[model samples]
Target: MRTLTFFNHKGGVGKTTLTVNVADALADQGLRVLMIDADPQCNLTAFYLDEKKLDALLGESDDADGGTLWSAIKPVVDGKGGIKPVDAYKIKNGLYLCPGDVLLADYEEELPAAWTGSFARKGRDYDVMCALSAAAREMGQRYEVDLVIYDIGPNVGPLNRAILLDSDFFCTPVAADLFSLRALSTVGRAVARWITDWKTVRGLASAESRDKLLHGLPTYLGYVTSAYKVSSGRISTRPHDYWESKIAPRVKNRVVDVLRAVDPTTVPFPSNKLAAIKDFHSLAPQAQEYGLAIGKLRTHVNSGYNAQILEAATEFSGLATIIRKRMGI
Candidate 1:
């Protein structure tokens, strides 16, 4: 099983959209998929289930009973290891989601006491990375997960750090704008630093161990421009074309340069064009009314919606293929 986190330090880059819909697309192909909504916003959860039902699913027990991911994962962190099998978890059919809560924001402040002195050591407390990855691994082993997709928040805090470190790889769904470019660069540096830091702490001596640990480090999966205008089944106008063609290449080159400057082995992933979700205005209204994801909605379908979904799905499918090739899958 492989874990992929869809992330960016920039919000509103369609991170949740890519994570949810891409998982749906993969599920459509009959692959077992698990999506973890690591963001406090829980937007992906909203996309798949109604609020009342979602609350019931998550609120089945009080927080102390290990009802949420925080409680569910604490045992692993405490060294009482082993994840509940995938089938034991609350997943429906081909896909399951580990929803995140606002409480997730508190993890950093509560960094396990053990992590304090470990910074100067040869390796980090395996508990930190292990707790997260091991849970995913165990679930994958149990259910034979084909893919694990994580929808993370827009920060370099402990929660995001843990998610990035745990995932086999990650992709940034960034907007084609200056702020997004800056945020991407910032995240690139953080990722590079974290990878090196964790590796050094691991005290990796054997070439094999070094290879295994570094292998999981996040690599760029290229950029996907969200909310792009479409007309005649293509990006409209020279400005949009320039943004799509020249500007994106230029910024992406700089991002790649930054990553390489920090670590030459860091390579950017191939990217593809994703037209805006068609009639987003209409789709948003419909989603709000019906409590459904535009992609998951069965009624009120339109050509624009179909086109957008297909475009987004195809782009992510191409990304999945590239990633599979990288992992030699």
Candidate 2:
């Protein structure tokens, strides 16, 4: 299965919302999709599960067991064993969710030491570094999924570094604002360095460990511009257009160009803008409340929301198609 991650260091960019809905849309198109909530915030998990179910999975209830992403990798983090098998929650016919845990933040503490020991080709350190990827692959194979999408927290932390390295492709979800524009350079520079560093470490690893290592080269799929207001069928406000106009040039200069300079072979896409997602407004909260995708929200609401529901369905469907085409799926 192909792995894709939706990431942006800037918060409040609707990254989790976009990831969940897009996975739902892909599932609707008959693809078996598995979503990994790698974010410690657990927002993606909360989106699909109610509080009681979430409490159980997160180990806050009497029925708690090994069902979360953290549960799978905890053994490796503690230097006890390889990753344990995790039973992903089936959200619908074709969509599944590997629940996230607030305890995931604790894994970050071990990463710094593992990263250092990796230079010496320490076997345990390699195991720790590759734990998440190995677990994800095992789960993907077990489920026979067509696509695996990861929803990571907003940061350039060690945990996120490992996730980005393991991913086959990544897309940035950004808002039409100054903060999102400024974040492009930070993400670009950090990823380039990580790729370079990973290459060095791979050469230092033993043959066996080298075979298990991914290339650490996640191709840029492009950016999704979200949370902008829409008129009849287009952007309504002048302020929104002004910021939107700035996105392409900034992304090209700050992100695409920087990445190309590091490894031209990895930069094959011609464009940086993937899709312009119109603001979902009321539909977002309604969908979240019911733990449903915007397209599926129609069944939970009255006739007055038919038009907005249709618009949401069309928007996410188009985004899913673009993503599939870009990935050559």
Candidate 3:
């Protein structure tokens, strides 16, 4: 299965929002999509389900349920088992979600312990790292998923390190701001460090031990500029210049290229401009409140708003189309 992650070390870049919408968009195209919410905040899960429903799935404390991504991997953290059978929640046709849990953050502290365990070729560390991968593979096969989309929290900790390592590709969603630009450089260096450290651990492990662990780098699949205005297929507003002239190139030269500094061979990366997702303005808040994609807001909007709805259809669809091409999904 092709596994991809939508990640940015900085938050407020619409990562979770874009993730759910993208999953829905892909589902609309008759492709099976599984969204694994690895963020401890559980925001992605909250989008698709209510607290009452989620409570039923999670049940009580000490439950070994795999209804959430945390429940699936929590056993590994507790030294009880490997990844449990992840019970993904169906959010309508062709779209599924392995929800996130707030309590998932509880396991974050043990990541350093798990890191040390890797040196002795232990199963716990490998098991924790590959938990999501195992879930993705099993669910992808069960659902015949076209792609597995992971929505993870913004961090360079052991948690994200493990998740990203197991993923095949990573695409960042960036806000058109200098903070986002600065974050790219930091994320780039952190990603390189993760890859290098994984290799060192892998080298120390025996063949049998290595077989249980996840190693190597996830390819950088370029970035999408979000929270930006668009007019007639070009960036709109004054900040548009910053995004076009500065943010986009920095993502390429500063982030993607810097992350690949270990490789001696030079290869030009793919165009960093995937698609500029429009800010969607008032439509976004209304859409989120109603749990609808920007493109699907027509069902909830008045007849006077057709033009804006149409714009959303074009924008979100173009995003799905371009990203699908990049992923061969």
Candidate 4:
């Protein structure tokens, strides 16, 4: 199965929004898709369920329950009846989600302790990464999933580290801002470190260990600029000149290239002009009348909102196609 992670170290960059929408879009295209909500905020899961539903899902959570991701992935891997299928709430025609739990954040403190016993057991029956890989593989086998979209949270802790080590390709979604740029650099470096360190731990190295590690590492698909608004000057004007010329190239030169040094196959996602999702204020409720996400508001007064969503969908679809082709999915 092909795994693609939508990640950014900095939050509020629309990582979960894009991941949910892209998974929906891919499902529309008839691809069997599984979205693993790896974020601790559970925002993606919230998008699929309202407050009451979330309460039911979290009924009487204890430390033993896989309410958190680390527990869930293990059972799926071991076939020990540990993993339970998510209910039909978010189940679409060709899409399913493992869903995220808020408890994931708490697991951060417990990861090293949980993993200590297996660290020294070389060639043992199980390792942390193997369990995750096995989970991915088994799920792929069961669902025959064409795509596995991982919606990861901020931070480079054990969870993110494990996901990076197991992912096939990653697409970073960052806001067009300075902090996002810095995060791009940080996450890039962390991914590189995880790859090399994971290889060392996997016992797959030899005299050509460095070369082999590079060969086995996941490809880094470059970042996507999200939540941008177009310039108001003219229809032809691009507001992201700073991003196109300055931010993109700097990341490519400083970060992507270094990762490529370890593995040349690493390539950027489509370098399209930033797909701008115009932020529209939701209209005042007329007697509690509802409307779609703000984009639908523009569809009535003007077609711009629909056009924007379509364009964003198209951009993600292109990235999806590239990822699929690379993974031969």
Q: TM-scores across all candidates?
A: 0.77, 0.94, 0.90, 0.75
Evaluated with TM-score, which candidate comes out highest?
2
Clash number for model 2?
Answer: 0
How do the residues 166-278 of candidate 4 rate in per-residue lDDT, one tens digit apiece? 67877777676667777877877887777666555455433442232222366666666654443345343346666556567766765677777766666544452234433
Question: Which residue pairs clash within candidate 4?
Answer: none
TM-score leaderboard ranking:
2, 3, 1, 4
Say what the RMSD of model 4 is. 6.0
Winner on TM-score between 1 and 2 is 2
Score candidate 4 by lDDT.
Answer: 0.59
Query: Tens-digit lDDT track for model 2 on 176-266?
Result: 7767889988888888888889989999988888998766888899999975544357755666568778888888888788889888866
Task: Report the C-alpha lDDT of model 3 over 1-329, residue by residue, as the tens digit.
Answer: 68888878998788887887887888898788988888888777777676787677656534754467666666777778766776677778898887777767776777777777777777767676576677667777888888888888887877788788887778888887767778888777877778888888899988887876775668777788876545457755676655768887787777777776764221235566777787777887777677677788887888777898888888777788877877776
> Could you tell which candidate, 1 or 4, scores higher by TM-score?
1
Cα TM-score of candidate 4: 0.75
Give lDDT: candidate 3, residue 24: 81
If ranked by lDDT, best first, what sequence of candidates would result?
2, 3, 1, 4
Q: All candidates' lDDT scores?
A: 0.60, 0.86, 0.76, 0.59
Candidate 3 error regions (>4 Å): 58-61, 227-239, 264-268
Question: Per-residue lDDT tens digits of candidate 1, residues 145-257?
Answer: 78888887788876677678777766666665557766866776778777776666456435543443424366665556664445457655555455556446654555666
**Candidate that would win on lDDT:** 2
